[model samples]
Target: MLKFVKGHMESIEGIATYPMISLLIFFVFFALLFWWVFTASKRYVREMSELPLDENNQ
Candidate 1:
């Protein structure tokens, strides 16, 4: 089953670029996430952190 799938995948056109495109997308997503985490406000982080413990949340 695996061999059949691999053979079919290898026959597709421009298949090599698929991995590169996927990697670029993955890298961009994490890069943006890292930037967001660092740029987020300390007050906002504290508020989110305490949300689960806040009694009024229920």
Candidate 2:
């Protein structure tokens, strides 16, 4: 099964670029998420963390 799939994939033109584009998208998404986590306000983080425990919201 693997051999057949690999052979079929190898016949397609521009298939190699798909993996590179997917990798770039994955890296950029995580990089932005990491940046946001670091730059987010402490107050906002604290509020979000306590949201589930806060009865007033219910």
Predicted model with the maximum TM-score: 2
lDDT (Cα atoms) of all candidates against the true structure? 0.98, 0.98
lDDT of 1 by residue, 25-50 (tens): 99999999999999999999999999
List candidate 1 segments past 4 Å from native: none
Instruction: Give the clashing pairs for model 2.
Output: none
TM-score of decoy 1:
0.85
TM-score of each: 0.85, 0.89
Off by over 4 Å in 2: none
Candidate 2 lDDT by residue in tens digits, 6-37: 99999999999999999999999999999999
| Lowest summed lDDT window (length 10), candidate 2 | 49-58
